[model samples]
Structure formats: structure tokens, C-alpha cells
Target chain A: MSEWWTYRPSSFLLFSARTYYRLFELYNAEIWPWQVLALLVGVAILVLLRKPGTWQGRTISALLAASWLWVAWAYLYSRYASINWMATYFAAAFALEALLLIVLGVGHGLVWRPPAAWISRAGIGLATFAVALQPLIGPLVGRSWSQVEVFAVAPDPTVVGTLGVLVLASGWPKWLLLPIPILWCLVSGATAWVMQSPDAALMPAAAALVIVAGGGSVLSRMAPARDASGTPALD
Target chain B: MDEIIKAPPLSRRRLLGALVATGAAAAVGPRISAAQPDAIITRPIPSTDEKLPAVGLGSWITFNVGYDDVARASCAEVMRDFFEAGGRLIDSSPMYGSSQATIGYGLYTLGKPPALFSADKVWTSPGSRGPPQIEVSRKQWNVPRFDLLQVHNLLAWKEHLPTLFAMKASGQLRYVGITTSEGRRHRDFEQIMRTQPLDFVQVSYNVLDREAEARILPLAQERGMAVIINRPFRQGALIDRVARHPLPSWAGEIGCVSWAQLLLKFIIAHPAVTCAIPATTRPAHARENVGAARGPLPDKVMRQRIESLVEQL
Candidate 1:
């Protein structure tokens, strides 16, 4: 079965850590031993997959493993040791996971590569600008900061997945990556309506507009015609 | 500050009558059987004019279990049982890992109760010199309107109290309270009660921790503000201390079957206290905690007996 089961080290690590944290809260000491066993299992899988990795993949994999370790440490520390510093440790681990993902994507040359014309590149740039501007506008408009995750020019899983598919199907304008931020903002804005906060709605709305308009402009510059080798002109 | 707000007032007597009618229709209403011989004690939230069972569940340690579907579903069942047995207050916080998210999920799946009193807190640094960061708290709890928003452990109380007061004026929150547990900030707790125009305050007030009664409880009663007692079990430390000993025979006279009831009943006996929130992960514990709400609260004389029972430990 052609299931969507292709392994990405970063995504798997993120999902596993999140799941373990949830289980830790529910079962506490009852499941602590099982979590330790799972950590070992995750390390074993990483070691087995280490051979076929590029420098970028290896680096990303190591960062992913580190994030999980941080999460486990946070859980243990909160349960058995210092209760006060647990939140700081958890937030730091979360931010590190986001940073590592961005670094891994850039290093692997996955982002900033346009499969289409220069217009598409410009469109992506505009989208990026829009996403970045969301936080500034959100508070002015009276939205909560948590809504920024949806509205701001932050990386989203769906957009990244789409970009990966597009890249593999046919090399288009590298700038196609730009619109992902815009798409995230739009979806985030729509979700904010239920939140019933003006600031919540405003931030996401602003982000969506920037990403879509800028990303559209960038995508427009790319030529559809293929070269003699049947690859697109940008590639 | 008195702007002659012309909102309709909720009648407590009428609301209580309506609630009792609904409780009767629900079939599993307050277990008032003569064989049980326990009168369920109910207390009113002065601000909202809503009466809730004296003992409520705290979701801090129990509900912070994260975002798993099965675990969340199990918690939903616990909440359902709690409400069916006449629970109204559900306490939570952003600081308890994914507790807010878990509560959001539970409330979503279980559907909200009309009389539900959602209480949460904003935990920031103590010496911080800015606003209480209300926006972050709103998102974390996933509630548009929080019934009671407390400053967790006097952390940035001066900063948060003003914002909470403003929210109260805006009709976004019905009550404003402050909480201090584990005996961390008695001085700050007394200071806030003395100065601020708060509607409620929460502190650790089990049989073991009666220091609040000396000053804090009387101050709250004088101020006419309700009180919520947390850490009634001393974060399970009290339980560990009293585990080997059997419950004294008189505990049954007041309808307390377990040590959990003995602890909660002692807290509820205080005149200033409106409710006591005990955190428990097990559903049976939730049921037993709620059962503490039933029967006659120990009188001043009996209160001394209950304390003496624990003092033996």
C-alpha cells in the first residue's frame, strides 16, 4: 500500500516527544519506565538509519534527537526534581525544535529554490513579508499572541509538505516556498474567528494577505516552458 | 468606578429553584437518600449569584496529561460523572504543561455546563513590571470568558489585579480571586486581602495547614469575599503521613468514609471558605471528593475533634 509513511527524522522526533509528554502527564511514574524504553528504541532506529544520510539529514536528525532528550529531561525534572524551572525548560525545547527544522530545511536547499519564473519568487517574498508583519499588527488590532502562530509568517507543516511534493514532481520556481507562510496565515486567521478576540482575528488576517499577494507576484514571474531536457527553465 | 451599570441581576433563589428542578429531572440528582443520611452542602458565588457544591475537582495534576485522544476521553468521562453528581467548579492553569489544552479538549468533548465555573490563573515572574499578560492566558485556557481569573501564587499580583479588574468591568469575567498554595506567600496573601477589592482568594487550608484561619480567613470574611481552599491534601504529603492509620469512628458520623473526605470536610468547615478544590487523577477519587460535599460539616466542637484526630499523626 502506497501509504504516506515516508520517514522524516525531524517530524518523527517532534511527534514522538509530544506524545511522550502527553503520556507522562497521564500515567506519570507508571509509564516512566516505558518512556525510557521508547527513547532507547528511537536512538536505535536513528543509528540504523544513519548510513544513508547526507550531512544536512544527519545534522537535522541529531537536533531532533536532542529536542526529544530535552523534553524527557524536562518531564523527569518536573516530576522528580525542580518544579519551578520546568516550564522554561519545556519552552526552550519547543523553540529549539522549530529553529532546528528551519535550519535543516535551508541547509538541504529545500527552501528559496524557485521552480517557476521570477514572479513566483516575488510572490513568495511578499508572502514572507506579510507573515512577518502579522505580530506587529495583531496587538494593535487587539489579538492574542498565541494566535500569531497561525497568522504570522511562521513555517507550517502542510505548506512544507506541499512544497516537498511540488519540488519532487517537477522543479519549478524556487520562490514557490514563499507562499507557504501566506497559506498558514490565512488558515490561522479563519481559525481565530471562533476565538472571539479582535486581536486574534486581525493578526492572522494580515498575515494571510501578505503571503498570498507576495507569493502570487513571485510565482507569476516563472515561465511554464521546459528546456530541451524536459526540465523546467528555472531548474 | 460606580458607573450605574444597568445589567439584569440574577436571582439566587429563583436560580436555585430552577437548578433543583433540573436536578430532579436528571434522575441522578443529589443523592439525598435517608439511608445515606448526608446533606449535600452547597455554596454560592456572590458575584454570579450561582451556587455550587462545596467541594469541587482541581484539574492541575490530573488533567495536565497532554493531548492524547484516549486519555482525554477518559478525563471527559470523569468530568461527566463529576457534573452529574453536582460539580460546577473546574480549576486549571497554563503553567501545568498541556493542562489548558487537555481541559479545552475535555470541555469540548463533554460539552460545557451552564453553571460551570471556569477558574484559571496567570503565572508570571514576581518582580516583573508590566501588565499581567492577559492575552497569553486567554489563548492558553481556550476560554473567551473566564468566570474567575486568579493571580497564581502572588506572581505579578499588582500587575495582574488591575487587568483582571478591568476585565470584570468589561463583563468578560464575573469574579477576581488570588491563590497561594504550599504555604509559599502568607504575607502577600494577607496584604492583598487587606488592600485589594478582590471577590475571592484561594489558599492551602487542610487540617494540617490552619495558619490561614488565624488571619487570612477572618480578613476574607470581613471583606465579604468568597474563599477557595487548594492543596487540601498538601499535594499528597498529608495522605502519605496519615495512610497507615484508620479513620476515627466519628468520621462516619459526619459521612466521611475516606481520609480524603476527612481532609476536605475540615477545609469546608471554615466559615470563610466557599469551596475546596482537591486535585485527583482517579475517577474514584473524584467521586469520593465530591461525596465530602454531602452530610453535616463538623461544628466548631467537632472541628476540634477532627483536628485532634490528625494531630495524633
Candidate 2:
């Protein structure tokens, strides 16, 4: 087998940028009314995140799991696989991520709590960007609104959203869940860069921001507990 | 094809200065009249003596538009123009995303041009999967049978080669061959070319990438095998690099009005190359590519001149 160093990222790119954008246009048309529903689900997740609790955490996880499973089956398997053979493997990995989320949510793994620091606030902002601002990038970059990648539907925003959600989480779930979305963002960022898309930096940048926040969440956990007041409190 | 790019008349002193600077005495080379050929230029396939057009269409990234109807219709237009311009061969592989299905849509939309020469490839592992993949590729192209089928990138060639030979012997396929690109696997490529009874071999060769000239071209000539040249423009990078410069004044000796045609003429002018396949997404570019086959080609001296000038650029 040939070594990996011999090949460039563009060598594996089998589709044109125009074709890639058109894929989303056609997909959006085919799955009409679902975009509306997916957006509603995203809004519901945001609402749940505002008031963190055990039940709210599980509900948010269930919502995210449903979105991941839908994207794996419909977008990756049914659509993207037609052009790229690698999408099959991507769909399988996405399905696995969804299953992991299901276990963390239903198996009573971790409790969702309000952030005590600016890092968690940044995570919330990143999640908001994926759900709200990311779609606007398409039209701003000369693509049509029909081709805008939406959260809970497209892989880029979904992965970004998951990373954001993970930053609001802690314990083993945060450690276990961060790798998949980060890897996806890096892969997709390289792909978009090869395609010369203007918003290519968004995914990789979101991944970086989440990694910092997730790390901060860990450091906060190790530190002495603090109350609503500025001073440290008894455990 | 008849359009000649007129250069400002240079004085004897200027012509000599340009010639010295460019290291080409192309001004004094044997000059063919700048007349387009009345018929499309063709070279004989060494194995069966079948004449294939010197220029063919390649579907790499250009035709992998997936299921977008708008993009698919645009591709159909490109194909329609290619056929009307007297091109015969259209090449694709299963590795090129949805290019095969896109080609099928174009063929079906055009009601299947009788002049279409369908060339495809088998790219799967373990060799047993070759037949099923080939069947799917045939269905995708909506063709009765492929004119040529090659093993892509030499993957699983040990197993795929025998399967291709059997298909060719049974007449289910017309030609059997193998392909490699970007200059990888040439040692194995050379070994296969020397040993296999292949009808065609597709390789990457252009003005800049001349690794093929040292051994592969000569080997193909020695073995009496046909050669299909891929990436004549280095997948559009070469053209982009030279698009801003004016064509060397001596280019008119071969009737090349555009850099695209000049680079293409450089490839097919070689005696061993049966065809050069250049992929494009626009109908105008498709028409321009086939125009390379319609005029006088660069002679040995002029081919050398083209290489030097492009190298400097």
C-alpha cells in the first residue's frame, strides 16, 4: 500500500464545490417541511439548556440523539454516499455517536448544571452560532438560501452543536464525547478548505473553542467548590 | 479551429532576440501551414488497429455532480456539444463520485449518441467483486457494453487482471487495460505493462509531468500497446498557471489559438499516445478541447519548443 504522505487532501476530493453546494439545495428540497421541524427541535434544545436539571439534560440528549440518527440515515447514507464512498463510514460513526449520547442520557450517567464560569458561557454562544449564525454563512458567501446548511440536518452544524452541548457537560461524558465531533470538524474543515469555501474556518474554530471550554470545565471541577458569592465555600 | 491568433509582426532583430532568450530556434523549424484538418485527427489503437480520436473527454471531478438536476442538465449540454464537435471517447471510473450516474443521465437525455465511445473502469478489492461492480457501472452508463475497461490505480490488480482478460475473451468487453495517475506505482506499472496483454494503459502525462517519457512511453511503443493520456493540464492547474500569458508567437505553426489546445497537442503529438482525455464542466471548454484534434500537431522540434517555453512560464 502507498504511504499516506504521498497524497494531498485535494487528491481525495472527488466532487466540485458547485456540486457540493447543489447537494444541499437538492436535499433541502427533497426533505421539505423537515427543516422547519429540525429548527424547532434546535429551539427546544436551546430552551432546555436555559434551565439545567436532570430531566432537562436527558431531554436535550434525547433530542440531539434523534437529530444525529436522522442525519446519519437520511443525509449521509441516502444522499452523500452517492458521490463519496467515505460517507458510509461517516454515517456509521455518526450512528455510534448517537448511541453513546443515548446511553449517557437514559442510563443516568451525568447531571446537567448551570455553568459557573465564562468557559461554559462561551459554549452556549458556540451552540447558538451553530444553530443560528451558521446557516447565514451560505447566503453571505454567495450560496443560495436553499443550500444553507441547517443544524440538526447538516453534518457541519450538527457536529458543532454537539461539541457545544458537550462543553456544557462534565464528568466522564465530556471526556468520552469530545473526540468524535472534534475529529469530524477537522476532517470537514480540511474538506471545505479544499473546496475553497469561504466559511471553511468555522468548523475547526468551533472545535478549538469547545476544547478550551471543556478543559476549563475539568479544572473547575477539581478546584474547591464556590457558592453564588465570590468567595470559595465548603464542600 | 480555423481562427489564428495574429501576433504583432516582429522585426528580424526582435524575432532573433526572442529566439535567443527562449532557447528555441522554432522560428526556423519546419513550419506546417496553419490549416485545420478537414477531418478529426485520430491515432490507431496498437492492439486492434481501431482508430480513436486524438482527444477524448474525462469525467473526474467535473462530472461528479451527484443528483442535482440543474448541474446534471448542464453536464448534458457539455456532452451534446462534445458529440456535435466530433468527439467519440468519454472516460470515467467508479472512484469519481457520482460521475458514472451523471454520465448516464447525460446519455439518456441526449437519447444516446451513436458516436459515443464508452470507456469505464473496475475499481474494487479481492477481484471477486469485479463482475458485480462492472455490471453496476454498465447499468449506470446505460450502455450495452463498454468499449474499454481498466483496473483503476492497480488496486487488487493481481486478481482483477485475470477477470478483465476473461471478460475481453468472452466478448462482453471490447478492450482490457489498467490505469495509474500522479506518477505513483510506476515500478509496478512498468512490470504490468511489460507482462500483461493489455489493450490500453491510461497514464498521467503533460508538459510539466514528463516522468512518463523516460520509460512508460517507450515501453508502450516497444510492446505495441495503446496509451491514453490523463491530466493533460495537470487537472486544470497547468492551464491556470499559463492562462495569463500570451501564447508563444511560434504556436501558430501548429494552429493552436488557446493554451488548452497547445498543451493537448503536446501530449497527442507523441507517437505512442492514442488519446488525451481532458475533463471540463463548461460546454464551451468541451468544444475547445475537441478542437485540439482538428489541426496540425507540433513536430519534434516544436514539441521541444513548447516544453521549454511552458517550463519558463
Candidate 3:
């Protein structure tokens, strides 16, 4: 880890931020009108989670998987890895996360009844933060518009929000879903720290929030069954 | 690695004169060659009779400052320090974000210094990307043409080599070279060196990472290829570790007043090494790095001792 730590902070940050800026500009120019569709889809997921309609889990997971796949192909593999070699591994992990989400939710046709617990409430807040508030972190911090990292369009917040939404899944596979977001946050945080970036605190902060909230939700879900029947809930 | 610079600006000329009057360049004491005064050392290019300075500035991360005005201004000052201290070779790549553009900006701030021996790299290609990337690189550097055009990390090199040769053959460039700053490609880099008709090669070579010493440096010598050493301070870690302690008593034998100069002098001392490009953003650090080019370089015996001393630290 120290060996990776040996790099000059600017080297990693410049490659990352520059690649991000380029992809952002390209995405903005080419997909100017279509971005509204992605935003509307994001709003639909939030509305579905708020009121458990038919196949709501399936819908949210499908949207989450699509976002992951898009960023994996468009940003990580196609753009970021061209400069930083580590992004190739990240792209693979993201693609795998997308497939897992699709199989677990879309394949099974699970219904998402939004949890009534405080942890799930907090998870909703986090998902909202990633979608609506995360993009503003860049502009509010004084970065140029070209350098803005938008959720669904950018890898970091897309993964962050996905983790928040997944934590609300009552019976979903938490183990399979948590690692990629956690790992990505660590990598992203280290990279930001190196770059002297304003968002340095955001990634590690997201990782910590995911661990506490995701783990708490899973624990809370297990506790009710174990207390009543003297058996672990997942089995 | 040689820095091609003009006569100093008036303010820096006064600073140089004052340093000379104080019996050293900056705070470095004594003289290895008093007659030469502050004249920077240069080594032959091997392929050509032209001499390159022993020290040059690298533009990997430090010079890739995008559009940040404060960072860009700092880069300009660093470039000024480098040229004023007799630097010439300013190396960059298309892979390094805005590095080529920043180098152009730094030089532009300095009135497009004549001492500039612009060196750049082509990082993309299916063969067609080479021409356009070079065109972009040329505009970024704001130079009519670069002194050297290198294949970056050997990516699509087979595809781009022909274009490089054609560029050189057509006088768009003076030298055609290949560069690999990663340890993973040392074997292939050596293979290319032995077989390719190259004028120069850049590689990661430093005190802590002596992997290049076994084969790459020797191959460059046997092949008469000019060598440019990167990561001489292991991308700032090695020197930062050594900088924690005071300089050793015998450090002055090669006239190193700082750990930066000591680390730099060690690399450039290798007779096969034509230049060592250490990137920096601070004008003070740039001046310190250029100091290694002055006075004397360490010989083989001293290089070993320098290695041993640094290891002990």
C-alpha cells in the first residue's frame, strides 16, 4: 500500500480529475437532451421506494445496474483506465456489481417494501444525497462546471447512491453488494487525498456511512426474527 | 536531458552574480571547477555530437495543472528557475492531462524561452491517432516541432513507430525514441532497445529502484542510446525520506548542499545517463534540482557509496 502511496499526489489526481473532466465534457455535449431522461428515471426510483408498487425492487435494481454498466463502459474502461491502470480493475468490479444486482433483483422479480426502521430512513436520505446533493458538491466547492461529478453520470456517486438504495433491500444479498462500494470509496478517497481535492473527505465518509447503515439495517432485519423464534433470519 | 537556455533575465542574472560572489551557486559551497563558475554540466547525446545538460525538468504531474491560475503561475515560476539555472529538456506526454499545455504555458510566461529543447510523447494510436495526437501535442507545447518524440510506455508502439520514423525522416523531429516508466515492461523495453533503431530511451532509474542498473542502462550503453532517467528520487519518496536527516559529512565531495542535489547527482553520474528529469512545482525545489547539474558528478565508486549511505539512512 505504501508503494502505491509513493506516487506524487498530483500524478494520481491530475490523471483522475483530467479524465473525469474530459468524460464530463464529452457526455454533456453528446447527451445534452437525454440527461433529463436519466434524471427522470432517478426520480422514478425514489418514488417507487417511497410507495411499494409492483416489482419496485426490480425497477430500482434495474436502474442501478444500468447506471453501473454505463459508467463502467463509458467512464472507467473507456476513459479513466486510459490514464490510470487501476481503473481497469475498478471497471471490472463495477461490471460485476451490475450483473449481481440484475440477477438478484430482476431475475427474482423481488418486491421492495421500503423498510420502516431508522436505518432505512437514513439510507433514503443518503440515496437522496448521492442523487441530488452529490453533484452539487463539485460546483459548491468551486470546481469548474466541466469538473462536476454527477451521480449516474459519474462512477463515485453512482456507486455511493446504489449502496444506499441496496441497504434498504429487506431480503437482498448484502454481502455481494457492499464490497464494491466500500472498496471503491477507499480507492476514491485515497486518490482524492493524493490530489489535494476538495472532495477528499466525501469518499471515505461515504464508505463509513455505508458500513454503519448497511450493516445496521442487516443486523436490524436479523434481530426481529432471532428474538421471536430463536433462529437467525437469513436462513 | 540537457536544458537549452538563453542568457539569464536581468533579475536572475543579478541573483547568479550574487551567488557566484558568495563562492557558490545559491547556498552550495566551494567549487569543483572554479574556472567554469556556475556553468551547468552537459553530456554528449551519443547518436549526435550535440550536448544535453545533465539535468532536465519532467512534466508528469507537476506541470499538468489544468486551468488553475494559481497552480499555472507556480509552474511558470518553476520553469523560470529551471531555465535560469541552465535547464533545456522539458519532457511531457499526451497521457499527462494538460502537462504539455502547461509546459507551453510555463514557457509562454517566460516569453517562449529559446533555451527550451521541447521533448514530448505520443500516447495514442491505431496509427491514425499518432498524427493528430502529435498535432495536439505540438499546439500544447506551442513549439513548431519537438526536439524528441517518444513512444509513451510502448503503448501501440509497433503501430506508432513507423509514424515516428516518418516524422523524424521528414524533419518534423530531430530524434525518435521510446519510453517506459513502469517496471513491468523492463524486459520488453530491453528487447526493443536491442533491436530497434532508436536515438534515446527514457526509463525509471533511481537509487532505491536499481532494477534498471542490471540490464536497461547497460543495453543503452552498448547500443549507444541516449538515456533519460525518470523517478530519480523515486517520485519524491526517496529524497523525502533522506531529507528528514542532515546531509552526510562526505556529501560535499560532489558539492551537494541538499538531499535533492545528492539524489540527482547520483543518477546523472552514470556515464550512460544523458539526462535525469525530476519534476517539481516549487521554484525553490526546481533551483535545488538544477544545482546537481553544476560542479562535479559522482564517479562509480562514489555512486556505490552514495547508495550505501542512503540505504543506511
**Maximum-lDDT candidate:** 2
Fnat of the models, one by one? 0.03, 0.73, 0.14
TM-score of chain A of each: 0.30, 0.94, 0.83
C-alpha RMSD over true interface residues, each candidate? 17.1, 1.3, 7.4
Chain A TM-score of model 1 versus the true structure?
A: 0.30
Segments in model 2 whose C-alpha atoms lie over 4 Å from true places: A113-116, A223-234, B1-29, B33-36
- The CAPRI classification for model 3 reads as incorrect
DockQ of each: 0.02, 0.67, 0.18
On TM-score, the candidate that comes out on top is 2
| Model 2: per-residue Cα lDDT over A149-193, one tens digit each | 999999998988878778888667766777878999998999899
Cα error, candidate 1, residue B292 (Å)? 0.8
- Give the per-residue lDDT of model 1 (tens digit) for B65-155: 5545676677777776666556778887655666666677767777666657888887776424223445655566567788888987777
Query: lDDT at A43 for candidate 3?
Result: 78
| Residue lDDT tens for model 2, B78-134 | 998787666889999999988999999999999999889899999998789999999
TM-score of every model?
A: 0.55, 0.91, 0.71
In the range B186-297, model 3's lDDT, one tens digit per residue, is 8788989988889999999888788888999889999989999888877677877888899986676666778889899889877789999999878988877887877666
- Model 2 residue B266 CA deviation (Å) reads 1.2
Q: Indicate the DockQ of the complex predicted as candidate 2.
A: 0.67
Error of 1 at A136 (Å): 50
